[model samples]
Target: MGITGTRQAYEFPAGGAPPLGEVRAWLRQQLSDVGRGTMADTELLTTELVTNAHEHADGVAELRVSVASDRDVVRVEVDDRRPHLRPRRVTKQDPTTPHGRGLALVEAISTEWGVATGTEYKTVWAEIPVL
Candidate 1:
Protein backbone atom coordinates (compact mmCIF):
# COMPACT_ATOMS: atom_id res chain seq x y z
CA MET A 1 0.00 0.00 0.00
CA GLY A 2 1.22 3.50 -0.93
CA ILE A 3 -0.31 6.80 0.02
CA THR A 4 0.06 10.20 -1.54
CA GLY A 5 -2.19 13.11 -0.67
CA THR A 6 -5.73 11.76 -0.44
CA ARG A 7 -5.20 8.57 -2.44
CA GLN A 8 -3.93 5.13 -1.56
CA ALA A 9 -3.49 2.24 -3.98
CA TYR A 10 -2.63 -1.43 -3.76
CA GLU A 11 -1.31 -3.52 -6.61
CA PHE A 12 -1.70 -7.29 -6.59
CA PRO A 13 0.92 -9.41 -8.32
CA ALA A 14 -1.09 -12.58 -7.77
CA GLY A 15 -4.03 -11.27 -9.79
CA GLY A 16 -6.88 -11.78 -7.35
CA ALA A 17 -8.89 -9.87 -4.79
CA PRO A 18 -7.22 -9.05 -1.52
CA PRO A 19 -8.91 -10.07 1.69
CA LEU A 20 -12.10 -8.05 2.19
CA GLY A 21 -11.32 -7.30 5.85
CA GLU A 22 -7.95 -5.78 5.03
CA VAL A 23 -9.38 -3.63 2.31
CA ARG A 24 -12.15 -2.40 4.57
CA ALA A 25 -9.76 -1.54 7.36
CA TRP A 26 -7.49 0.33 4.99
CA LEU A 27 -10.45 2.29 3.71
CA ARG A 28 -11.71 3.03 7.19
CA GLN A 29 -8.34 4.38 8.23
CA GLN A 30 -8.26 6.63 5.20
CA LEU A 31 -11.66 8.01 6.14
CA SER A 32 -10.96 9.42 9.57
CA ASP A 33 -13.11 12.47 8.86
CA VAL A 34 -16.19 10.53 7.83
CA GLY A 35 -18.98 9.28 10.05
CA ARG A 36 -19.60 5.62 10.81
CA GLY A 37 -22.49 5.46 8.36
CA THR A 38 -20.36 6.74 5.50
CA MET A 39 -17.54 4.41 6.46
CA ALA A 40 -19.86 1.42 6.46
CA ASP A 41 -21.26 2.29 3.08
CA THR A 42 -17.81 2.76 1.61
CA GLU A 43 -16.62 -0.55 2.99
CA LEU A 44 -19.62 -2.45 1.73
CA LEU A 45 -19.44 -0.94 -1.75
CA THR A 46 -15.70 -1.50 -2.05
CA THR A 47 -16.09 -5.14 -1.06
CA GLU A 48 -18.76 -5.62 -3.68
CA LEU A 49 -16.61 -4.14 -6.46
CA VAL A 50 -13.54 -6.16 -5.53
CA THR A 51 -15.47 -9.40 -5.12
CA ASN A 52 -17.23 -8.90 -8.43
CA ALA A 53 -13.98 -8.35 -10.30
CA HIS A 54 -12.37 -11.41 -8.76
CA GLU A 55 -15.35 -13.60 -9.56
CA HIS A 56 -16.23 -12.33 -13.04
CA ALA A 57 -13.29 -10.47 -14.52
CA ASP A 58 -10.69 -13.19 -14.11
CA GLY A 59 -9.09 -11.40 -11.13
CA VAL A 60 -8.18 -8.03 -9.75
CA ALA A 61 -4.92 -6.44 -10.80
CA GLU A 62 -5.10 -3.41 -8.56
CA LEU A 63 -7.28 -1.63 -6.08
CA ARG A 64 -7.36 2.12 -5.65
CA VAL A 65 -9.05 3.98 -2.83
CA SER A 66 -9.23 7.74 -2.77
CA VAL A 67 -11.09 10.45 -0.99
CA ALA A 68 -11.92 13.73 -2.64
CA SER A 69 -9.74 16.65 -1.59
CA ASP A 70 -12.80 18.40 -0.32
CA ARG A 71 -13.98 15.26 1.43
CA ASP A 72 -17.20 15.15 -0.55
CA VAL A 73 -16.85 11.52 -1.63
CA VAL A 74 -14.74 8.45 -1.36
CA ARG A 75 -14.03 6.54 -4.56
CA VAL A 76 -13.04 2.91 -4.79
CA GLU A 77 -11.86 1.31 -8.01
CA VAL A 78 -11.05 -2.31 -8.82
CA ASP A 79 -8.97 -2.96 -11.90
CA ASP A 80 -8.63 -6.26 -13.70
CA ARG A 81 -6.76 -7.45 -16.78
CA ARG A 82 -9.91 -8.61 -18.53
CA PRO A 83 -11.22 -5.56 -20.35
CA HIS A 84 -14.09 -7.44 -21.96
CA LEU A 85 -15.90 -8.13 -18.70
CA ARG A 86 -18.15 -5.56 -17.09
CA PRO A 87 -20.47 -5.47 -14.10
CA ARG A 88 -24.15 -6.12 -14.50
CA ARG A 89 -27.01 -5.52 -12.10
CA VAL A 90 -29.16 -8.55 -11.41
CA THR A 91 -32.81 -7.70 -11.86
CA LYS A 92 -34.10 -10.91 -10.33
CA GLN A 93 -32.64 -12.00 -7.03
CA ASP A 94 -33.52 -15.14 -5.11
CA PRO A 95 -34.29 -14.67 -1.45
CA THR A 96 -32.48 -17.83 -0.38
CA THR A 97 -29.34 -17.19 -2.42
CA PRO A 98 -26.31 -15.23 -1.30
CA HIS A 99 -24.98 -14.56 -4.83
CA GLY A 100 -25.88 -12.07 -7.55
CA ARG A 101 -26.62 -9.11 -5.29
CA GLY A 102 -23.31 -7.24 -5.32
CA LEU A 103 -23.99 -4.90 -8.16
CA ALA A 104 -27.44 -4.18 -6.87
CA LEU A 105 -25.96 -3.05 -3.57
CA VAL A 106 -23.49 -0.89 -5.44
CA GLU A 107 -26.28 0.74 -7.44
CA ALA A 108 -28.28 1.48 -4.35
CA ILE A 109 -25.46 2.83 -2.19
CA SER A 110 -23.02 4.53 -4.50
CA THR A 111 -23.60 8.17 -5.28
CA GLU A 112 -21.99 7.60 -8.65
CA TRP A 113 -20.38 4.59 -10.29
CA GLY A 114 -19.14 3.37 -13.67
CA VAL A 115 -16.54 1.42 -15.58
CA ALA A 116 -13.51 2.44 -17.62
CA THR A 117 -11.69 0.26 -20.10
CA GLY A 118 -8.21 0.42 -21.48
CA THR A 119 -6.62 -1.79 -24.11
CA GLU A 120 -5.82 -4.55 -21.63
CA TYR A 121 -7.69 -3.67 -18.43
CA LYS A 122 -11.03 -2.54 -17.11
CA THR A 123 -11.68 -0.64 -13.87
CA VAL A 124 -14.97 -0.73 -12.08
CA TRP A 125 -15.44 2.24 -9.76
CA ALA A 126 -17.94 3.64 -7.31
CA GLU A 127 -18.13 6.85 -5.31
CA ILE A 128 -19.89 7.09 -1.97
CA PRO A 129 -20.76 10.48 -0.54
CA VAL A 130 -19.13 11.45 2.73
CA LEU A 131 -21.73 12.15 5.34
Candidate 2:
Protein backbone atom coordinates (compact mmCIF):
# COMPACT_ATOMS: atom_id res chain seq x y z
CA MET A 1 0.00 0.00 0.00
CA GLY A 2 2.89 2.34 0.42
CA ILE A 3 3.64 4.17 -2.80
CA THR A 4 6.39 1.90 -4.06
CA GLY A 5 6.03 3.39 -7.51
CA THR A 6 3.83 6.03 -9.08
CA ARG A 7 0.14 5.28 -9.30
CA GLN A 8 -0.77 7.83 -11.97
CA ALA A 9 0.43 11.18 -13.33
CA TYR A 10 -0.19 13.85 -15.98
CA GLU A 11 1.67 16.91 -17.27
CA PHE A 12 0.82 20.15 -19.02
CA PRO A 13 2.63 23.10 -20.65
CA ALA A 14 4.91 25.48 -18.80
CA GLY A 15 2.35 28.30 -18.94
CA GLY A 16 -0.85 27.25 -20.54
CA ALA A 17 -4.44 26.45 -19.75
CA PRO A 18 -4.34 22.81 -18.77
CA PRO A 19 -7.31 21.18 -20.38
CA LEU A 20 -9.38 20.89 -17.22
CA GLY A 21 -11.92 18.49 -18.62
CA GLU A 22 -9.27 16.22 -20.02
CA VAL A 23 -7.30 16.24 -16.80
CA ARG A 24 -10.32 15.35 -14.72
CA ALA A 25 -11.46 12.69 -17.09
CA TRP A 26 -8.06 11.04 -17.20
CA LEU A 27 -7.69 11.08 -13.41
CA ARG A 28 -11.13 9.66 -12.84
CA GLN A 29 -10.53 7.00 -15.41
CA GLN A 30 -7.28 6.05 -13.79
CA LEU A 31 -8.78 5.95 -10.32
CA SER A 32 -11.62 3.77 -11.45
CA ASP A 33 -9.34 1.60 -13.48
CA VAL A 34 -7.35 0.91 -10.36
CA GLY A 35 -10.48 -0.10 -8.40
CA ARG A 36 -10.19 2.77 -5.94
CA GLY A 37 -13.79 3.79 -6.54
CA THR A 38 -14.35 7.43 -7.41
CA MET A 39 -13.52 10.49 -5.41
CA ALA A 40 -16.14 13.11 -6.02
CA ASP A 41 -14.11 16.07 -4.81
CA THR A 42 -11.22 15.40 -7.20
CA GLU A 43 -12.61 17.74 -9.82
CA LEU A 44 -12.91 20.62 -7.37
CA LEU A 45 -9.52 19.90 -5.88
CA THR A 46 -7.78 19.86 -9.24
CA THR A 47 -9.59 23.00 -10.34
CA GLU A 48 -8.73 24.99 -7.25
CA LEU A 49 -5.10 23.95 -7.29
CA VAL A 50 -4.60 24.38 -11.02
CA THR A 51 -6.51 27.64 -11.14
CA ASN A 52 -4.57 29.00 -8.20
CA ALA A 53 -1.32 28.28 -10.00
CA HIS A 54 -2.66 29.49 -13.31
CA GLU A 55 -4.03 32.76 -11.97
CA HIS A 56 -0.87 33.56 -10.08
CA ALA A 57 1.94 32.47 -12.40
CA ASP A 58 -0.14 32.87 -15.59
CA GLY A 59 -0.05 29.05 -15.67
CA VAL A 60 1.94 26.14 -14.36
CA ALA A 61 5.06 24.64 -15.80
CA GLU A 62 3.77 21.18 -14.93
CA LEU A 63 1.36 19.40 -12.64
CA ARG A 64 2.07 16.16 -10.78
CA VAL A 65 0.07 13.68 -8.71
CA SER A 66 1.30 10.96 -6.41
CA VAL A 67 -0.84 8.57 -4.43
CA ALA A 68 0.31 6.72 -1.36
CA SER A 69 -2.27 4.02 -0.83
CA ASP A 70 -0.67 2.89 2.39
CA ARG A 71 -1.18 6.35 3.77
CA ASP A 72 -4.48 6.62 1.95
CA VAL A 73 -3.53 10.02 0.63
CA VAL A 74 -3.32 11.56 -2.81
CA ARG A 75 -0.94 14.46 -3.27
CA VAL A 76 -1.32 16.87 -6.16
CA GLU A 77 1.19 19.59 -6.94
CA VAL A 78 1.45 22.33 -9.50
CA ASP A 79 4.77 23.91 -10.38
CA ASP A 80 4.97 27.52 -11.43
CA ARG A 81 7.79 29.69 -12.69
CA ARG A 82 7.38 32.34 -9.97
CA PRO A 83 9.02 31.26 -6.77
CA HIS A 84 8.16 34.54 -5.06
CA LEU A 85 4.45 34.03 -5.35
CA ARG A 86 3.18 31.40 -2.95
CA PRO A 87 -0.29 30.42 -1.93
CA ARG A 88 -1.73 32.46 0.92
CA ARG A 89 -4.52 31.57 3.33
CA VAL A 90 -7.73 33.43 2.73
CA THR A 91 -9.32 34.24 6.07
CA LYS A 92 -12.80 34.82 4.78
CA GLN A 93 -14.98 34.18 1.78
CA ASP A 94 -16.84 36.91 -0.02
CA PRO A 95 -19.87 35.70 -1.89
CA THR A 96 -19.83 38.79 -4.04
CA THR A 97 -16.25 38.46 -5.20
CA PRO A 98 -15.68 36.52 -8.38
CA HIS A 99 -12.12 35.57 -7.49
CA GLY A 100 -9.81 34.91 -4.47
CA ARG A 101 -11.46 31.78 -3.11
CA GLY A 102 -9.42 28.98 -4.62
CA LEU A 103 -7.06 28.61 -1.67
CA ALA A 104 -9.90 28.88 0.77
CA LEU A 105 -11.66 26.01 -0.91
CA VAL A 106 -8.38 24.10 -1.09
CA GLU A 107 -7.83 24.62 2.63
CA ALA A 108 -11.36 23.59 3.41
CA ILE A 109 -11.08 20.27 1.64
CA SER A 110 -7.45 19.18 1.58
CA THR A 111 -6.20 16.80 4.27
CA GLU A 112 -2.96 18.77 4.31
CA TRP A 113 -1.48 21.45 2.08
CA GLY A 114 1.64 23.62 1.71
CA VAL A 115 4.10 25.12 -0.73
CA ALA A 116 7.54 24.00 -1.82
CA THR A 117 9.71 26.89 -3.00
CA GLY A 118 12.59 26.38 -5.37
CA THR A 119 15.06 28.83 -6.89
CA GLU A 120 13.36 28.68 -10.25
CA TYR A 121 9.86 27.34 -9.55
CA LYS A 122 7.40 26.85 -6.71
CA THR A 123 5.06 23.94 -6.20
CA VAL A 124 1.81 24.15 -4.29
CA TRP A 125 0.77 20.73 -3.09
CA ALA A 126 -2.24 19.29 -1.33
CA GLU A 127 -3.09 15.89 0.11
CA ILE A 128 -6.56 14.41 -0.15
CA PRO A 129 -7.60 11.51 1.98
CA VAL A 130 -8.77 8.40 0.17
CA LEU A 131 -11.36 6.00 1.47
Candidate 3:
Protein backbone atom coordinates (compact mmCIF):
# COMPACT_ATOMS: atom_id res chain seq x y z
CA MET A 1 0.00 0.00 0.00
CA GLY A 2 1.24 3.48 -0.88
CA ILE A 3 0.45 6.62 1.05
CA THR A 4 -0.22 9.89 -0.75
CA GLY A 5 -1.84 12.96 0.71
CA THR A 6 -1.64 16.73 0.57
CA ARG A 7 -3.02 19.49 2.72
CA GLN A 8 -4.87 22.58 1.55
CA ALA A 9 -3.03 25.83 1.04
CA TYR A 10 -2.31 27.85 4.18
CA GLU A 11 -1.83 31.56 3.67
CA PHE A 12 -0.31 33.95 6.18
CA PRO A 13 0.77 37.57 6.22
CA ALA A 14 4.27 38.19 4.94
CA GLY A 15 6.87 39.11 7.54
CA GLY A 16 4.46 38.00 10.20
CA ALA A 17 5.29 34.97 12.29
CA PRO A 18 2.61 32.32 12.52
CA PRO A 19 2.10 30.24 15.60
CA LEU A 20 4.44 27.26 15.37
CA GLY A 21 2.53 25.32 17.99
CA GLU A 22 -0.72 25.63 16.08
CA VAL A 23 0.89 24.61 12.83
CA ARG A 24 2.50 21.57 14.44
CA ALA A 25 -0.73 20.48 16.02
CA TRP A 26 -2.61 20.74 12.75
CA LEU A 27 0.11 18.80 10.94
CA ARG A 28 0.07 16.13 13.61
CA GLN A 29 -3.63 15.62 13.13
CA GLN A 30 -3.34 15.55 9.35
CA LEU A 31 -0.48 13.05 9.33
CA SER A 32 -1.62 10.88 12.20
CA ASP A 33 -1.42 7.71 10.15
CA VAL A 34 2.18 8.42 9.23
CA GLY A 35 5.11 7.54 11.44
CA ARG A 36 5.69 9.79 14.43
CA GLY A 37 9.39 10.46 13.73
CA THR A 38 8.72 11.50 10.16
CA MET A 39 5.84 13.69 11.26
CA ALA A 40 7.95 15.43 13.88
CA ASP A 41 10.78 16.14 11.47
CA THR A 42 8.38 17.46 8.85
CA GLU A 43 6.76 19.79 11.34
CA LEU A 44 10.11 21.14 12.51
CA LEU A 45 11.38 21.76 9.00
CA THR A 46 8.09 23.37 8.03
CA THR A 47 8.38 25.76 10.93
CA GLU A 48 11.91 26.72 9.91
CA LEU A 49 10.94 27.41 6.30
CA VAL A 50 7.78 29.30 7.24
CA THR A 51 9.58 31.35 9.87
CA ASN A 52 12.19 32.34 7.32
CA ALA A 53 9.51 33.40 4.88
CA HIS A 54 7.74 35.45 7.54
CA GLU A 55 10.90 37.13 8.77
CA HIS A 56 12.83 37.76 5.55
CA ALA A 57 10.22 38.24 2.83
CA ASP A 58 7.37 40.62 2.21
CA GLY A 59 3.81 40.43 0.87
CA VAL A 60 2.21 37.04 1.64
CA ALA A 61 3.45 33.59 2.58
CA GLU A 62 1.90 30.21 1.90
CA LEU A 63 2.63 26.66 3.08
CA ARG A 64 1.98 23.19 1.77
CA VAL A 65 2.68 19.74 3.20
CA SER A 66 2.70 16.67 1.03
CA VAL A 67 3.42 13.02 1.79
CA ALA A 68 4.23 10.36 -0.77
CA SER A 69 4.76 6.82 0.38
CA ASP A 70 5.71 5.62 -3.08
CA ARG A 71 8.56 8.08 -3.08
CA ASP A 72 9.30 7.42 0.61
CA VAL A 73 9.43 11.13 1.33
CA VAL A 74 7.51 13.93 2.97
CA ARG A 75 7.93 17.40 1.53
CA VAL A 76 7.22 20.78 3.06
CA GLU A 77 7.25 24.02 1.11
CA VAL A 78 6.94 27.63 2.20
CA ASP A 79 6.13 30.16 -0.49
CA ASP A 80 6.54 33.90 -0.26
CA ARG A 81 5.48 36.70 -2.59
CA ARG A 82 8.94 38.24 -2.72
CA PRO A 83 11.11 36.54 -5.31
CA HIS A 84 14.12 38.77 -4.81
CA LEU A 85 15.26 37.28 -1.52
CA ARG A 86 16.86 34.13 -2.82
CA PRO A 87 17.58 31.31 -0.38
CA ARG A 88 21.28 30.61 0.04
CA ARG A 89 23.56 28.43 2.10
CA VAL A 90 25.31 30.57 4.67
CA THR A 91 28.94 29.86 5.58
CA LYS A 92 29.60 31.75 8.73
CA GLN A 93 32.98 31.67 10.38
CA ASP A 94 31.95 33.40 13.55
CA PRO A 95 29.51 31.40 15.64
CA THR A 96 28.59 34.39 17.78
CA THR A 97 26.31 36.08 15.29
CA PRO A 98 22.94 37.02 16.67
CA HIS A 99 21.12 35.79 13.58
CA GLY A 100 21.43 33.88 10.23
CA ARG A 101 21.36 30.16 11.03
CA GLY A 102 18.04 28.89 9.73
CA LEU A 103 19.21 27.28 6.50
CA ALA A 104 21.98 25.49 8.30
CA LEU A 105 19.55 23.85 10.65
CA VAL A 106 17.28 22.88 7.77
CA GLU A 107 20.18 21.27 5.91
CA ALA A 108 21.32 19.43 8.99
CA ILE A 109 17.94 17.78 9.51
CA SER A 110 16.29 17.26 6.14
CA THR A 111 17.48 14.73 3.60
CA GLU A 112 17.44 17.51 0.98
CA TRP A 113 16.21 21.09 0.71
CA GLY A 114 16.32 23.93 -1.82
CA VAL A 115 14.53 26.90 -3.23
CA ALA A 116 12.22 27.05 -6.24
CA THR A 117 11.70 30.43 -7.82
CA GLY A 118 8.91 31.49 -10.14
CA THR A 119 7.95 34.67 -11.92
CA GLU A 120 6.19 36.18 -8.92
CA TYR A 121 7.14 34.09 -5.88
CA LYS A 122 9.73 31.77 -4.41
CA THR A 123 9.21 28.57 -2.47
CA VAL A 124 11.74 27.14 -0.07
CA TRP A 125 11.24 23.43 0.38
CA ALA A 126 12.67 20.55 2.37
CA GLU A 127 12.20 16.81 2.05
CA ILE A 128 12.80 14.15 4.67
CA PRO A 129 12.81 10.45 4.12
CA VAL A 130 9.90 8.58 5.75
CA LEU A 131 11.68 5.30 6.28
Best model number under lDDT: 1
Over the stretch 1-131, how does candidate 3's per-residue lDDT look in tens digits? 12366555666643445878878887776667678788878787877787787777863367777786667788788888888789778886468986678888899889888888998999888888885
Model 1 residue 18 CA deviation in Å: 2.5
* Per-model TM values vs. the true structure: 0.87, 0.85, 0.85
Candidate 3 residue runs with Cα over 4 Å from true position: 1-7, 13-15
Give the alpha carbon lDDT tens digit for every residue of 1-131 in model 1. 12224567876658444687877877777676778898899889988888888888787888888877565777888898899876777898899997999999999999889999999999999988877
Q: After TM-score superposition, what is the CA distance of residue 128 in candidate 1 from its true location, in Å?
A: 0.5
Ranking by TM-score: 1, 3, 2
lDDT of each: 0.81, 0.74, 0.77
- Cα displacement (angstroms), candidate 1, residue 60, comes to 1.0
Candidates in descending lDDT order: 1, 3, 2
- Which clashing pairs does model 2 show? 1-70
Worst 10 residues of 2 by lDDT: 30-39
TM-score of 3: 0.85
